[model samples]
Target: MPKLTTPISDEEIRSLKAGDTVYLNGIIVTGRDAAHKFMIEHFIKKPVQPDEQELYDDLKELLDGGVIYHCGPVVKTHDDGSYSFVAAGPTTSIREEVYQADVIRHFNLKGVIGKGGMGGNTLKACAEQPAVYLHAIGGAASYIAQSVKEVLGVYKLEFGVPEAMWVIRVEDFPVVVTMDSHGTSLHDTIQAQSKEVLVGLIS
Candidate 1:
């Protein structure tokens, strides 16, 4: 497991190939369907205040070749008025198959994180955008949640926790690289290889 830490840049992420293991630290935003829709619908051009713009600006440079964790956490505030992650499970990567590639390009994002592989559209998106896809272990909610150290901000809280965008700081988040910038997919390779071996054995 590669120990991944803060101040990560786009160049660093692009340099990584498929099949590498990474332990992510620092901050990453969490976004899903509703949050995605809202961001796309925000046509107001209201000119965000300086403080508000800071997050996205920082996000751009760091994410220029970094990853997005597709997680919807279970959060409850503490008596001290601080929040924490309860269950930080990876959402199915397929749900955002529709918007992922486009989002990756729009944000200049380098990689995406989720569970259960994504299909060809996203894989193609990865190829075109030179983005990569990462897989988090499914059902390891509590273990994964431990990595979330803080929530800096959130968007669309009305959409509830799962559908909202959570801007969080994490430490030592575990993930496996499953897709490459060149469009080579670990899932596809596994499926095809599995079939060939199974057929050979049956014959």
Candidate 2:
């Protein structure tokens, strides 16, 4: 399997193709529906307020050349106030279809990890921004958590565990490239082929 790391370069992202298995290392960020909407509405689209400027800066620093995981991880809190992931499975990426493209561009993201693939907007954003969409095993939450070496930090805890933004460090995190930076999508091809097969059977 190919290896990927945070702060991934444009060259690295462009070299990936659909169907390539990869192991991701270094740092990744987590977000879901609420986080996505917050990023777009509060951070990216409008002017940052005095109170939010700090948050905006922090997000910029964290997200630069990083990977975003579409996950609502199960976390455990220790007595020392430290946190750990119990299960970290990829959520259905289509939920963020409305905001992903803008998020990628605004954050300079290189990769996205999720299941069920994304749509045309995200595909176009991938092509334009030279990013890749990686597919993690949906049912393999515990296995995925094994790769997360540390829980670096988190933001927006108000949204609760599922919607909070989690910053994590991972080692040899496994995923498959389903959408490549070159505008190639395994999901799209599979869907089209499936439709064709259905039509043939009906004829």
Candidate 3:
């Protein structure tokens, strides 16, 4: 229940433990499996397109050093070339294990936003890279989408919607950082501690 001062740094996130709370007011991005596949396909091959960097860069600057949410929002594009988000459920964090570390490293991201906590490899990657993992509240995508008032833009039509990169403008998106850069995972640690205590009393 400590008070956090201004400009919370990467080092500060490492010392945070389970049940610790933080208030953040920074930019965050949304990406999912489609986006990941696109990145990996281009990364593995020569390149998906000559302007791949441009595709990523167009919205990445706003995302770098900020959080990236693992979400593939269901949006409705209007006839006038505008769109509105209908549903925005969070995708599983485990699915991103393949490239989460790479994306974090490449973009120098500060934190990751998703539903469930990731595995050991991701935990270690977070520690070494000085980033954090966040858990979003479930069953609240409709409310969450309301927070997004405008659609800034989209990237890579070749990938298409769901896979095509999108840039949105949100009013106040809510989230919580559940893992930090010091190998502290709220999900892992809590499960272990709970199991030990329950077994001890029952035995």
Candidate 4:
């Protein structure tokens, strides 16, 4: 399997193909519905006014060139108060379809990881921005957690543990590219082909 790391370059993303198995390393930020909504409403939708350099800088530092994981992990706190991921399976990605494109453009994100597939808008954004969508295996939460090496930090805990944005460091995190920067999507192809097959059978 090919390996990728955080701050992934545009060239590397372009080289990826749909159905490629990739082992990801380095940092990734976890975000689900609430986090996506918050980011879009506050950081992306709001115009960067003259006095808001700090706001822009903060978002850029956290998201630029990073991979956004559509995950709400189960974490455990140790005696020393450090956190560990007990289970970290991917959430369904289509839930964020409305906000994903803008988030990708605003953050200059390199990749997204989730289960199931996204819609046309996300496919367009990935193509235009040179990003890729990696699919993590569903129902394999505990297995996935083994790849997470460290809990760097977290944000927006007010949304509770499940929805909070968790910044984590992972090593050889496994995923498959279902959508690529070349405007190809394995999910889309499969769906269309399946429909055609059904039509032929019924006809």
Scored by CA lDDT, what does every candidate get?
0.76, 0.94, 0.70, 0.92
lDDT of 4 by residue, 77-155 (tens): 9999889999999999999999999999989999999999999999999999989999999978999999999998888
Our model 4 lands, by Cα RMSD against the true structure, at 2.1
**Candidate 3: global Cα-lDDT?**
0.70
Best by TM-score: 2
- Which run of 10 residues does model 1 get worst, by summed lDDT? 39-48
Writing each residue's lDDT as its tens digit, candidate 2 over 1-203 gives: 68988899999998999999999999889999999999999988899899989888988988899999999999999999999999999999999999999999999999999999999999999999989999999979999999998998899999999889999999999999999999999999999999999999999
- Model 1 lDDT per residue over 147-184, tens place: 88888777667889787777788888888879877777
Query: What's the CA RMSD for each of the models?
Result: 3.8, 0.8, 3.8, 2.1
Among all windows of ten consecutive residues in candidate 4, which has the lowest summed lDDT? 50-59
**Model 3: residues with Cα > 4 Å off, grouped in runs:** 1-17, 20-26, 44-49, 157-160, 197-203
**lDDT by residue (tens digit), candidate 3, 78-111:** 9998988887757788888887887777766777
Which candidate, 2 or 4, would have the higher lDDT against the true structure? Answer: 2
Q: Which prediction has the highest lDDT against the true structure?
A: 2
Relative to the true structure, candidate 3 reaches a TM of: 0.78
Record all residue pairs in model 4 with backbone atoms less than 3 Å apart, i.e. clashing.
none
Q: What ranking emerges by lDDT with the best candidate at the front? A: 2, 4, 1, 3
